[model samples]
Target: MDRARLAGFLRARREALQPEDVGLPRGPRRRTGGLRREEVAALSGMSADYYSRIEQQRGPHPSEQMLAALARGLRLSLAERDHLFQLGGFPVPRHAVRADHVNPGMMRILDRLQDTPAQVVNHLGETLAQTAPAVALLGDETRHSGLARSAHYRWFTDPQARTPVPAEDHATRSRLMAAHLHAAYTRDGRGSRAAVIVDALLATSAEFAELWREHPVQSAYCPPKRLRHPEVGALELHCQVLVDPDQSQTLMVFTAAPGTESDEKLRLLAVIGAQRV
Candidate 1:
């Protein structure tokens, strides 16, 4: 990753804020950019030395609370806040993941969901297991890809892939998912794999970078999604995500409730899958 560029970005962002931006008093004869290290530390409830180290990119990992404080003190935009967390080697604080691997029971659950689109996602949205329907939903025959590498990245970065969702919702979803991944990274101790994904996404999509600044939070729950398939026109699907009570795995299922047009379409999709098989 571009440590120097990240440091420079952090410094530049900090310098651009006025004292009033974070409720600090403007000191007389201030010649430097943004708030001083002491001022930021005071606002963020951290020591000046510690804040200095962060600015210098020499500090140890920061806690989620501390990062939140700094984000507020710096008046960082959402994207900027995400960037700060990335630089600090801390996962973005949102929906935290537990450090355990998937279990046999959860895998069995995925297998049982044969007709429904179901998959297992970690806190970072990595696909650990998937049913046949889930793989078909992603237009992939094999369930080997990570959710982080799937349409989440493409929806924001690729205009062609983004044609399905409304622009505003698309952007919101992107930010929310990134925030969820960030939270997972934080919970899992900010591993290199997470960092690499974040960096690659940022490099490829300015929209992702902009949304990342927003610092959104995502929980594993059911939500409705609007999708426009190339041949199917428009579809609204309800997404249900169940977190294993005993493990860190999240079981996600998508279904179209009975007696709806979406249900009919889903049935059609299933038939298509059967034909392909």
Candidate 2:
């Protein structure tokens, strides 16, 4: 890896971003205008010490995953993200088909929605990032790996995946999830990740297999959802989706009507703050 160049690039990018740029507050005691190493590390989902070592050019070679995390954390453009991978002695990511790398503009919007239940998901239903409130409401969808990374896969394979939604909604949710996967599979074609997930589910989930035969089509609209939170009881929320120009990623914001019980429950969720009671 080009240690010197990579360190320089990281430092420059970190310094260029202001607190407001990433939805962080500039406290009265703040000295420099740029974001601190800890702030960047927090946003990047890495330890401050680990990030510090990289800036000092004394750490081990960063892996591709690490570089991708840094790219997302810094809200780097596609060009800058590719440069970051190059400096780390890796190939430039094929972000066109690989939807893991969220757009910087979308990341900025997610950053601003810290208090709202907001998350960004790729076309294949892989969660790219989530706000704290989203975590509180949705239980950290980004934590899964492999086929389980796709909610469509998890919904049929893992029973607990559907815990948030009420029992009455399970069949409808299953159909929608299957239809969404079918859309992704059709778009990506065979040998794509979507197809891989489809193949896996076809082998394992009888429900998914049955749904696939019916050839369900996903609708353009995202309808209201009823969720049964363990701590907060029942909630009826509307999901607002903002699709990226590329149509590869979508930002989903969950909100309830004003002056309603669900809205009050959401307020209580803010206070609960991702902690399960």
Candidate 3:
């Protein structure tokens, strides 16, 4: 890796971001022109010292995962992210249909929705990032790996995937998940991640196999979602989706009607934070 050049690039990017740019408050006594190392590290999901060592050019070579996290944390564009990978002595990630990279504009919008139950999910139903309230509402959907990463895969195979939704909704939810996966598979043909998920589900999940035969397709509208939180009880919320066509990612924000019990429950969830419900 070109440690000097990498360090310089990282430093310049870090200095270019202000607290307000990333939805952080600027304290009255703050003197730094941009976000602190610790703030960047926190945003990147790494330790402050680990990030500092990179800027100092004294740490071990950063892995591709680390570079990707840095790119997201710094709100780098696709061009900037590819440059980061190159500087780290790695090949640029292939720009394809299954774009796991969350767009910087989307991240900025998500940062501003800290108190709202919101998350960024790719087309394959893999969650990329979530707000604290989202974790409280939907658990940490980003914690899964492999095929389990896709919600469509989990709905039919993992019982725990249906925990938040009521048992009565399971049948309808399953159909919806199937339809969503079918849409993704149609967009991304053979050998794509969507196809991989489909092939695996067809082999393993009898329910998914049965549904695949029906050829369900997702509707343009997203219906209201009903969720049961252990602490908050039943909450009927409306999900607002913002689509990023370029990245094939959707930003989902959940909210309840004003002056309703569900609205109060959502506010309570924000206070509960990310504590496992």
Among residues 3 or more apart in sequence or in different chains, the pairs in candidate 1 whose N, CA or C atoms overlap within 3 Å are: 15-34, 78-213, 78-214, 79-212, 79-213, 79-214, 80-213
lDDT of 2 by residue, 29-116 (tens): 9988789999999888899999999999997888888888999899998889899999999888774445888899999999899999
Query: Which residue pairs clash within candidate 2?
Result: none
The order of the candidates by TM-score, greatest first, is 3, 2, 1
Instruction: List clashing residue pairs in candidate 3.
Output: none
RMSD for each of the candidates: 20.8, 1.2, 1.2
Whole-model lDDT values for every prediction: 0.64, 0.92, 0.92
Q: Give per-model TM-scores.
A: 0.55, 0.97, 0.97
Better of 1 and 3 by TM-score: 3
Which is the better candidate, 1 or 2, if ranked by TM-score?
Answer: 2
For model 1, what is the C-alpha lDDT against the true structure? 0.64
Q: Which segments of model 2 are wrong by more than 4 Å?
A: none
Candidate 3's C-alpha runs over 4 A off are none
For candidate 2, what is the total of clashing residue pairs? Answer: 0
Cα lDDT of candidate 3 equals 0.92
